[model samples]
Target: MKNRNDKQGNLPPEIPHKKRFIIFLSVFAFLSVAVLIRYAVLMLRPADTENTGNTKPFVERGPILDRNGRILALQTRLGNITVWRPDIIDRDVLSRDLAPILQIPAETIDARIESSSADFIYLKKQVEQSTLREIENLKAEGRLRGVGVEAIVGRIYPEKRLASQIIGFVGNENNNGLAGIEYALESELSPASVKAKGGSGNQVFLTIDSNVQHILEEIGERIRRESRAEAVMFMAMDPRTGDILGSASLPNFDPNDINSSDDISRMDRPAIWAYEPGSVFKVFSMSALMESGSVNSGTVFVCDGHYERISNRGERVVINCLGAHGRVTIRDIIIKSCNAGAAYAADRLGADAFNELLQNYGFGARTGAGNPGETVGYLSPTSRWSERSKPTIAMGQEIAVSALQMVQAASAVANDGVLVPPRIVSRIVSPKGETIRSYEAPEGRGQSRRILKAETARAMRSYMVDVTSDIGTGWRANIRDLSLAVKTGTAQLIDPKTNAYSPTDFIASCIALLPAESPSLILYLAIIKPKGDSYLGGRIAAPPIREAAEALVDYLGIPRGRNPQISHPGSVSLPLPISPVVDAVVPNLEGYSKRELLPMLLREDLHIEISGDGWVRRQAPPPGSPLNSDTVIILELE
Candidate 1:
């Protein structure tokens, strides 16, 4: 025992066990205090931590604008009314109070709260600013404890039903695009930068001019209503750049009121709907045949009302014609839209060769125009062709096509042999209007594909010009003093139940090129299953084409022929009317040329209807008239 005590004393001075235990406790307590202080420092600090320094605030979705910079679709700050069940002091009172402000039934709100499985339920979504203000006011007064308005960015279409299918609608929950250009360019339109530096998505500018679109819609609506057609698609394009100027599909729905519309009304018919185009396709067929050296301008065929073909199976195949035309040349085939003559011309080429030529014209494939649900339009391959397929396809039977495809195919003739693929989106730009990306067809992709020889295209245009003459099928499409090349089609609709062409139902369609020698515009109109006394394309569709051309000619300032130049006095200086008026009044627009008032046409706030072409001859609002949103500044030019 002595040895153990002596060894322990030699090691160190002995302290009380209680003192040693207190020392350890004090050390631990000091460390705990230090840790608590550190935690408190971290907790009390601002959220500018190293990790959070790079975090970005949420950004709003960008706007979709027309080619003229008119807002088609834009995001608005919308509030969604939500209910927290646990926080609700009085569910009955909350529901009753919220009902009228939300434009909802009180009983319905009450029923929703009672039936809800979730503690939190959305009472109403997309609450207007006025409505949200009311709810917010009540909440400020402690009237609504559980009822909260959560802020959300929502899409709003200011133009309503105008270009609805082209702009498309987003999902209610995630705001993802469901159709049209929205769906096709989702990444470009959505605020994807929220994950990075946080900025608005790139703005998409379409090639469609709102004024031109309005004109087409006005005409298409009239055609649909007067003809009692099932549907209508009227589209216009610049043949040079393939920029779609206007596209209007009837039975259009307002994107703001999408829930009230169905899929049929929402369909982008010009891009998505595919049907068998009749004689209008003859132009393409003849072009293909002519390009292959199978037919020429001088080549002639005899027609006895219908085309007769002998199949390998010893079957008689017949494709009827609109008229007998005793003898027809390639020019007559196009001018008269003679199906028998077209079939005879097609017979000169082999099956594979004919199909290949048509395929080169952007048939049997998507035009890559950036439409989401665009159909390839059923053009069967040579392998799938029957014995009667050659002649049948020649006269625009059996093969199906879309209005977009028709426009794209016709560009070859209009562009003097170059095929320009249709492009709806002109460019994608940043929120600040900086060009993010410019869109154009890639090389080796029909950007410069000469689908026809220059001579062949010229010849084709010349033949199509005759179609607008008094003797041709498209004579009704002619405009006085303006050279127009036109093609009219009246195709029979196929009955789904019968799997054959419907006897009563027909599609009346027309395609026209203005200033036939050097076309600047191509207009296409199709009225499907038109119910009327007359279903001929010339009678029903051609007149609309003429009306559209006449308006477009004056609106676009296309030269109606060479006019004598009138010299203005050099001493007389007049300021160009840029802004309408400082007070939003209709200024003195008289004596100003049509070009002077053009800038006013682009204003979203003003609706100016200009008729005729020279200097301003008359004004509706008069000088210094207060211009409101509904004010129509009518300018008549001479």
Candidate 2:
């Protein structure tokens, strides 16, 4: 190395280069170390000081709509008030500050904050955005610490308690369904269900007619008040389509405040509750006896207040009637609701045949209403029947059935012996309004089957028409010039505590098939444990059934010319006006509410993409554009 020192007293250029490199390295290492220290400090910091956690992934859930496109349940963007427990910093001060904002007692807030051991907890959910802004402002001012908020999807029920028992409420645990349609159709309405099928799902449409549902609720409320019963239930269905048009249960709860509702208020009595149907069961029994060729309309029996018979095992069975008739025909027995006469008729039908008929009529099986907690009503097989079983069952006692089951059974009678299975859901549609699938009963289900001869059904209708006459038990149900086949029932309730029938507890019920000649609507009503001046079915349940029928008849326009249903499978009827089918071109959707646009959007041939909220302000290609795969009707809402 020629000389380490530079010439003319200058230092070596290499020395300066090495010194510069060392200095640059020292600076870089120091910067790296500083960065590492800062990162470690952050990792060690307490989470309370940070506004983290409490964020639930925002996934869209489908809406619940009525058959007519009325919104029943929907999801909206809302905020959740969250708090960092450790960061509460000052529990007393924070609770005091939050008390006014949360509209709760400061003591309550204080207790909540002190009870939690978690680093984070939700103070409240579904808080309004405007309300959250106030909280955020207070937190930024250092007045409220350890407080955070998460934007969440909130469920809302616009109809309040209208169909609470049927729609069900969502539980806080993962927002799963707890009961009603919400529970039954959970897989179709849940976020995970949507993901499993695709990215998003179509809305769920129920066959429930909102107007008719309102009518049932109105009439049922009156009956519940007048009878002072423990509870009441009313359900109406279309016998032709098995569509439940209206349903109402007393003591209903508002799903919006489900946490505050009691168990009884949330119960869907029509589908879940079972009771002895009393005289109404006679209708099916008489129909069965007549159809089986065991008895005819002119078949006569003596009822001297009671009927006594000897069992095959030598046991004696005796049943009492409401009144003694010396000689009664099958038609007279029905008109008078004679228990003894019915028992005599049942004796001729034989136990095996009667039980088989009841089972075939769907007595011992669930109505398959697609609802949860439905009881298949108790109908013991002939093998399990006691000596008194036949007579007791003929009088609508000793065997239990739900209101929905009764409706299904009556639908057969009104439908001319063609059993139409009941269905609650109509179809599931994509958000763009295209139908993905229909809920029609598969293969054997929802399909009609001949259960009895049309001639027998007509004779039963004639006897039922007399039931609304002046001397009939269902006299209170008479409407001038309104033709209907009706039956009334009253059975003493079996006290659960004693497992014995209690005289003080009785269920009054009534059923009607309108326009007796060619019935389409079937209405069933029951008042449980009625305590009034009169507890008879005619006095307690008949008038309300008439009122409901009148309202529904007007609402449904039932008097219009109609075709009688066929007994063959896969037969169809035009009982109601069908909604117009969607054409390939876009229809004019202007001046329609967002809710009204839903039915049109549900057309399978249309692709609708909605933007913003509220009514439509602008749309692409107007209303008559020829739709195509690339055609996306851009809807701008204001």
Candidate 3:
């Protein structure tokens, strides 16, 4: 409302140019101070924002050990080299220094440091300690840019190829578990650290005994070499508890370099592959008969080498008998491996009862042993059975079974009619050596089912022992000091295209229980498609059984039948000095039977080659020369 001159007068007059500049500078200084105070407060306060990116490296993984506390697998510290590209002072100099130590191309290192996009890049992982030391020396010289090393856990196997399939292996990234126990118990064995910030690590304890595993692998290798078979699988278990002591499959791959192996060789054959078990299956057929109360061990049947079909399907199935066994009891049938006898028994016990008994024995079913890729063998339903199915199945054809199933089923018989579920993992121990989890032996099949009486098992065991004695098919499996009860099987492989048996290919198998009366150990060995030799199980598989039994007896320290009398150092020889048998030239014992050669060998106190069936064709230590008592004589048979 006032006059314009009066309102203008209320405001100060315009300053000189220099004075105005000072005023402007004063305002800018105040604004700058305010900005600086805000920035300082922001920097001084703790960051509320989460890091979102974690930098601390991995914690160590624990060990995988066998039942004997032997290290099967372990994790060791390894060095990984990484670079901070932005921090790299001289890319060329760094490349020059690191190229030789890291064994990487110099160009690769130079390119990595020159790249503007990467904040951090890995140069090398799992570098050995020695290589890491070399890299550190370059870093001290100020020529290795921003390269830094972090310790990482690397998986390692002490026993290279032993039990490779069963133990499995880890992978490239962080050495995480990939297969076998590594895959099965990944979470439990690799737990997050207690800090809840890194990888969890713990020890996994397996039921496998490393010593037993070594023995099994050694014997399996021997069998594969001797039989020249396509593949061989051997497994041993504690019959009382179904604890697998050892499992070995030939053509094994070293887990340390698993990438070099084929997928087939990497598979755990004993648990994965299924086959048509031959005469060895007679035990189950016989058990089915006894379980149904239709027959006993004394049940007898006449065997004329073949069984004619009574059903109207016009299916005439031939039951091949090893020899003409006359009227034979169930025990005799099993011991003699008479196919006709088994067919008769299956016919006597109807299909329904037979199948039920098989089911009760845990056949045609998976054992659920917690192994990866376990096969539940094929067992056709009752409705699907053909007219010849009964006899064919009784004679060990048609039904397919995994080696693990055979072992588990036999465990029932060995455990006195109570089946115990097999297990590979014994327990899980924490990193602190405290037990985190313990696996107890699982109970047998069903609560109400009883497959056979204790007396029946004992009687069957006796008959089984007879099979390894003079009169039965498994006589070749006899051990020197231990009693071996074994059954031999030679299964014909069916050609899918022809829908018929292949003449040349056969699966030779032998299953034995040592100390036949009360078996503590049960062993099963199978040689698939053996070549360049006799394919009979008695010839190819029995010898391995004997070797395994002998090795096991020594390993377990089982008291020998008769301990050798210890001689005192100063003890004198008998008054009448026993005349030492004069060394004689080795004899041509080819084509001679055990009976024919026994007396001669005893008279000369000579060691003899007495393996396989039939007469010998070749002999070691040519005949008619002075032979020392310590000399071993080899015999060849045609």
Candidate 4:
């Protein structure tokens, strides 16, 4: 070294300078490596960012409509109030501001904000648009912190409880189908909506006619009021096609608020509940005999109003009838509703043959009507049948059937022995308005079993008509201008504990086909546990059938009376009586009490105006005229 002291005093040597440069290069390399490693780590990490900030919240579901294009169920957008705890600036202030507006307690808001476990929470769900707008105004002014709105889809029912049991309701989470048509057509009714845009969806079409449904409901309500029944179920269908036109079960609830209703209220009774069909089963019994080639419509039997059987166990079963008929033909049996005659026919057909007929009619099997909770009614197996079973079943005792099954079976008679399946949904359309699928009327699905001949059906229909005419038990069911064929049934409900009929408890029912010659509509009515005067089907159920028929005839515009040109010359013509003419001064019944005006109007034969419950207030054709007996005066009251 030239001189260590001299080099130290002046500057660093050449070798020391080279060493410092090496140290600088090494530090630069280490820094570059560290930066590269950090870059790789960030690229490899999973993207788990919260989706709370996503613009669209929920996807829309499909719409369900009735046959006439009336919307039954649909989806609509609703707002929800959400909160971000971390962004909240003044928790105490926010709590007080939102408590009353959101209907939430102040303490609840405070606790939610203090919860470090949750990044966000909901303040309220499905708030109305108006209410949400008010909250948004507050949020914009900074009075509320971390609060935002999200749009969500919810199910809506326009007609409330009109067809709740058929249309069904939806669940909250994701708007899934819950019951009725919703459950039956879940996949179709709940199709995926357009990609996250929350747009409208596909449409599902049903076969129910809302007008016919209204008529049925009105008739059922009237029956409930008149009979004071525990419950009433009325159903009408095209018996040839198995297309249910109208169906109603009393004590119905609105599906929009289905959660508030009891489970029993939601149960669809027509497809779910099974009951003894009473004498209505006699139609099937008579058909079974005719189908077996063992009996004809002219076949006669004696009925002493009781049927007795000696069982294999030495037990005697005594079955009582409604009345005594000395000798009755098959037609007469149907007319009088003779239980003994029906039991005798069952005895002639024998147990195995009769059971086969019952099974053929879909009594023990599901109707496959695409309904939820369909019941397979009671029918004893061939091996388990007892001697008493035959007689009891003959009079509609030992077997049970759902209302749907009864209607489906009757469809055979109405369709010339061709059995068709029943369905509610008519077609399903995609969101783009393309038809995806359609459900046709129930056909036998390749099963070639024929129950009755066309001729037999015609004969049976003729006999059923007599049941509604002057000489039958169901005379009350007669419609003035329409030919109605109906059968009335009054079955005694057996107490399960005693295995005997209860005197006071009865199930009154009627099954009818209108325009008997070429029936288009078939109706069935059942009133359970009616409380008022009579328990007979004629008195309790027949009038409802008449009312329903009258409404339907007026609605459908079915031509009244047969072709006049085809009438027989010697047909027993009844003379129409003409009322006597009255010429008198019209009475000023206005402002007069109904109690005071009744006697004066009746004595003078002058038309009177009566309005309010208390008294008449105003009248037309004022107080005097040579009043035409046929003219009716107008009245107004307060």
Candidate 5:
């Protein structure tokens, strides 16, 4: 003990001192390196800021923003309130204390605690920070016990029902996306930079504009109410860039109350529901027919209310038209929406060639709109066509399509034959505003796609203009002097029971391209099973779209090609759809536009309080209120 140096000199001869020293140095170096790496990992890991025995604060999931940086979906500061069974002494007292704050019944909370499934259960999930703080303070002060808050991310849709179907909603309190854009962009939306830290996740920028989305929702809701249809599908797109301005399907559910909604109510119809498109198919078929040189602008055919054809299989096919189209050119066929004429035109292109053309036109496939559960649509091979299948499909029947596919196909016509793939999210940005990734199309518009010739697309657009003209079937779609190329359609719904078309059910639809000279926006609208007085596409589907598009033009500040002196230049107010007065004596104000009624707003006899902005969707006093002093009229606009 007195001399350690003397003890080392007396060590066993079998073990060399230098060798032992070398081994000890090597072991020390390895341990030192391992410790340094572990320290670095601990230092670099995300720091949890909450001090109340919680690992992290809520709001780790990134925010979803619209094209202009408006928030759509995001995470809020809320934590899951859980109960530890062992810590809980009196279940009744705990439940009673939480009932008022959590907005849950005491019985429910008590029952959950009593359940034998798990020792611990969430008393309330996703409670605001303020509420959780109060509960924690009470627990710390001995006023409460057993209750704990687990800081976890909570998904919030700020816009409520606006674009709800498109943005979708998360499931439970896990913040896991269950459908739509939420599911489609989970990787981008989920936290990657931090395991469970606030404000560390990336943000997704969509091509949608909140303003545009609100307008579409309003118009689609109005159309649904007027038509008494099951639902309406509406889409708006910037053809040049493949930017989806709006995708709406009504009736939609509010994301804030996701559990209350059904699958049918939350469906993204434009991408999910595929049905026969009726006359809207003519746009694609006619474009293909013209693009293939099978039919030219000058090509003419006579219609006598019927089309007769014989297939290679010795099968005869007969098709009926809405009316006799007489001698018509390609323009006339579209303007009049002549089903027989369209079938004839498709017949001229031959089954194989026409089918190929339509397939290339973006039908029979998904439009790549980036929404989950997108349907590719159904298109039977030409080889499988029956004697009548060709003509039926030619007229927009015997085939299935989604609204997204239709709008994407129509973009080719609007963009001068360029087939830009439809997309929702345009770019992703980090929390610090750094660009992570971008999905926008390149500078050159016509990059890898030319589904139609420039001239052919132009010709098709021109024909659509006639569709909204006075002489065309889409007269209801026409806005006075508004430059728009549009086509309207009405298709019978097929009965699942009989495998035949339902006589009482129909789908009314229309597609429009604004500023017809050089198109910019492509708007498509469709109503399913309209029960309104007029089931025609021109009647039920066109008017609401026309109104919606006009509102869009105003909000977007899209430049009109015409003179500068004009204000509200595109359209005159639409005439009333129904008779305004009950007795036809009160001077009906039912069908007048807001601009047309501004003069009446000055009248003292009638005190009219307008409820909303946009076209007059409804009116009070039955439009027949007797004219008198102090007569208050309530007008509702969409």
Candidate 6:
């Protein structure tokens, strides 16, 4: 009994019901506060933690623009039309309604859905906005059940096929670049996050001018079709700044329909295709010879239709020429394109010195113009030279060079002996038009290195001008009022089976620098494997140079040298004398020549309307009236 009473007392009085409830409330309040604090910490953390995993949030890619701010390639919203077979009530009705909008036959759409192994199938991909709208309207009207549009980010080339090879195309799966500038600058064009460092997915502006590119493409296509050539590559560049204005490769593809094009049609030939440059190489060879002190303007070499050299092993090496240009100086060699003269001049230098000189001209290196698949071309070291290698190379054989290399090398001549590295991209700009980086070097300042002496360049240019003169090989390139320094080449292709020059296959090409004395523009064009009546460079390739030069001279507003003065007869006599206006009244301008109306034309108050050329034959208001604000002085001249 005592123990029971003591134990009950030891419990120390039972807590009040209100106090116990208060204790429970306190413990719950602490837990609630802790949870609130934890949530706040999570909300304050930086978003970078979310990307710690393998997945990343997609960001909008930037656009590709031309130098003039023309949109070439851009990110666009396209929809993939999808269908769920389980949701479909009537397949024929759905296909019929979507056929016209999708530009596909109803039967084709039915077949695609019928042969599907899964419940869902894509009706079409990359559907245009206009077509997507039509489908959406039908869906909203409850016409096509189970049909849906899955929104996706896609690329569209606004210019279509204009510069397809340069712009390239994006892959369907991940929207990654597959080729061209799209692939070359993928990281810059596509960003991982909105807050990416350096610059956000910025706009890539190319040096290519759409207007000039259009002109080159138009001309290249014409030449390709007419000459029946395998392909054609044309390019234009600002020789001083090394900005490639236009690079056109014929047989181009429409990036919008990339699957329709093959490998050959999609190649950027100007920067990638390497071939023997034929007589055009003579320009560089001659320049190298002059720079090495091996030959001068006055040095003369005899050309008896062929160049013959005897090796120490009693081997006779003979190189044939186009013709016998007798007693020819270096100038004559350039004008006539004499292989014998170029070979004899090259004979004066050692193989190592000649190879070094040629390398300095950018023959064996890539121009780095930003095109994918660019080739460095081929130029073996002097140690690999055979007995006839020197003379053969001198005459434009046993060496291969890309079109870009040729353009880069010619820039030295056009820029007065300085070699400027070519650049295709002009700048990287933000989406808001902020300049992030500039690729164009300031005028007269860039990565320029001297390749030839100033005087040597001038001499070479002068000799090249003679090539467009009456007696030279490139005379067909001459323009009426424009002065152009031109070089033409016709190289025979090597047959794979024979391993020798092919008699039927040839590459005809021409290069021109307008305003020979102070050149500003350089244009190069080549027609590969021209199967025409005449494959000679002078006959086929030179004419296109003249044609392009004329268009460029007009488009670029380049000065067309000096025009011949023409004597004009004095002003013709009018039928009647003009009367002077007094007190703000209309004057009798009838029968007065335009020259006599010079003062009246400058009056701000009078609205003068004059038509035709000779003199005022008829005057409105009968030639005598007070001038008013609404009165237009209409003088009909004959």
- 290-364 per-residue lDDT for model 2 (tens digits): 988998966888999998998778988888777787788887787788989998888887788788888888998
Model 2: lDDT equals: 0.80
Once superposed on the true structure, which residue ranges of model 1 sit more than 4 Å away at CA?
A: 1-57, 81-124, 130-150, 193-196, 311-313, 441-446, 562-638
Off by over 4 Å in 6: 1-58, 83-119, 138-147, 193-200, 442-446, 562-638
List residue ranges in candidate 2 displaced over 4 A: 1-57, 81-124, 128-150, 196-199, 441-446, 560-638
Evaluated against the true structure, the overall lDDT of model 6 is 0.82
Please give, for residues 365-451, the per-residue lDDT of candidate 3 as tens digits: 888776788898899898999888888898889999999889887876766676666778888887777887887656433322346
Q: Write the per-residue lDDT of candidate 4 for residues 1-638, one digit (tens) a residue.
A: 57877767865458788888999999999999999997777677654323435645445678888888888887776677888877888889889998888878999878877875787887777666667878879977867878888766667787887767888788876467778988777766654532322354567888788888888888887887888887788998887667787878776788766657987667788888898989887877787678787678667788887777666789886777878876777777788888877777667776788788778888998887767888999998868877778767867887889989888888777766766666677788877778878775455344334677766666677677778756677888887556776889998788888888887888899999777655778899998888866989988899889988888877876544531111122121212111232255555556644323322333334444545443456777777755786667666644
Poorest 10 consecutive residues of model 5 by lDDT?
A: 563-572
lDDT for each candidate structure: 0.83, 0.80, 0.76, 0.74, 0.78, 0.82
Clashing residue pairs in candidate 2 (N, C-alpha, C atoms within 3 angstroms): 202-429, 433-601, 433-602
Scored by TM-score, the top model is: 6
Candidate 2 lDDT score at position 582: 34
Residue 101 Cα positional deviation in candidate 6, in Å, after optimal superposition: 4.1
| Residue 559 C-alpha lDDT in model 1 | 72
**Where is the poorest 10-residue window by lDDT in model 3?**
563-572
- Model 1, position 290, has a per-residue lDDT of 92
- Count of clashing residue pairs in every prediction: 0, 3, 5, 1, 1, 0
Report the lDDT tens digits of candidate 6 across residue range 424-477: 899888767789888867244456799898778877886787787667789888
